[model samples]
Target: MPRFRLLPDEQLARSPLSQLWREFARQHSAVAGLILFTAFFALAILAPLITPHGPYWQNDALLLLPPSWSELGLVQYPLGTDDLGRDLFSRILVGARYTFGIAVITVIGALLMGLLLGTLAGMSRGVKSSVFNHILDLALTIPSLLLAIIIVAILGPGLLNTTWAIMLALLPQFVHGIRNAIAEQLSQDYVIAYRLDGANNWQIFSRIVIPNIWEKLTLMATMALSTAILDIAALGFLGLGAQAPSAEWGAIIADSLDLIYIAPAGVAIPGLLIFLAVLSVNLVGDGLRTAAKKRREN
Candidate 1:
């Protein structure tokens, strides 16, 4: 019987998050990015506890109130209120949850489907790969926003439909990335050796190709998550997303656009949040990519 030993210190040093952080820390930009990302995620998670009022509750007296250090000499509206007198700060916080939640779901759905399809396409030779790749190319050729609009039009506007729209739009990109990664791995000597050893396609896929490309796929997933969030917000802003009074960032922005002059904070709050969230995600993606590259080099 053979006894298996735990990984030695040197081997353990190469663990995922550990190596990722080390490389990430070496890059100042990545550090800043992580901070931004963490802050927004924290905000989203803690919205209920942090916010002063219900995001959707309206107060006629407070309508269009300017952001101030103190409201009515007692309470304060830090980010002000919308035309309907809803707390901008509170709405922003709650909206963060909606925006982030939809983005996450859409990204995960698209990534899963794309990864499976891409893996199949890459492992196959000749007409199969060609057919899948062509389909992907066709999907990619169409403008994502336009495609999303059409889908939303048919499905009707709502949070779930918007998520579906974004997922369908993003699926092609994930498929392309995974397909490329698998194709590159397929040419590696280890893969050929695994095949020559009479390993079945599924065995080779699960044991060899997947493990090799896991890091890249993770990085792509993170990037796609960020993009998905942005796309969802964009769709919402265009009126093809979450409906009114939903406290979604895009919906808030769209609703506030009319009151820009009367109460700019309504629009600014959601817009700024959307921008920050997307920016933070992008930074995290860059950090993850950098970390992956470092691990690969090591």
Candidate 2:
């Protein structure tokens, strides 16, 4: 009845998830990214409760106030005020909803649609597959931001429309990635074995194909989410995404450009937030990709 403890290798060998987690943790930047992303997500979810002032609330007396740390600044408005007298800190906290939340939802929709369409395209042969691949290639040639802009133009401005536009733009990439992963997975000898063992196409796809290609799919999803966030922010900056009074990060940056010289922090802080969010997502995705590759090699 003496106590026993498993070694690191023993633990990893006993649990695939533990192995993956270990590999992921080896990347320090990715761990930091995960922490930053969690904080941003929490801010987005708890903005209403945590924010000192309403995102849209205005006080003429507080217009263009400097940060609280500044000599001229007031403690009440920590990050200071925008030209419209709205609280910058409050706006940033709330902006996470549009910047991160909508992008997440859009990426989820794109991945879902891509899985179905890509599976169909991957499973098809001759003319059907060829035609679909050609269409995907054509779509891939367009930059995501440009494609989103076109879609938003047709759908008109606002957060809802921008989300849809980003989704549509992202769909082609997801479809292409999924289709390729499926095709590659299907070429494995195990798939032929499954067919010979009397497995139906649906069963083989849902069980064998999906399980085998899950790592690649997950990597694609993480990368796609970062793209979606950037597209949403760019559209908002261009005045084609979230409308005024929304406090979306990109919109906040756009509204503060004129004040950059006078109130540099107003512009720099929001841009810095966007930079951090995108960097965090990319670092996490890169870490996942590296971990998956190492796992496969092992």
Q: Per-residue alpha-carbon lDDT of model 1 for 229-249, expressed as tens digits?
A: 777888788888988888888
Cα deviation at 5, candidate 1, in Å, is 27
Question: How well does each candidate superpose onto the true structure, as a TM-score?
Answer: 0.90, 0.95
* lDDT accuracy of residue 218 in candidate 2: 81
**Using TM-score as the measure, which candidate wins?**
2
What's the residue-level lDDT of 188 in candidate 1?
A: 87
Q: Candidate 1 at 57: error in angstroms?
A: 1.1
Off by over 4 Å in 1: 1-13, 70-74
Candidate 2: count of backbone clashes, pairs at least 3 residues apart or interchain:
0
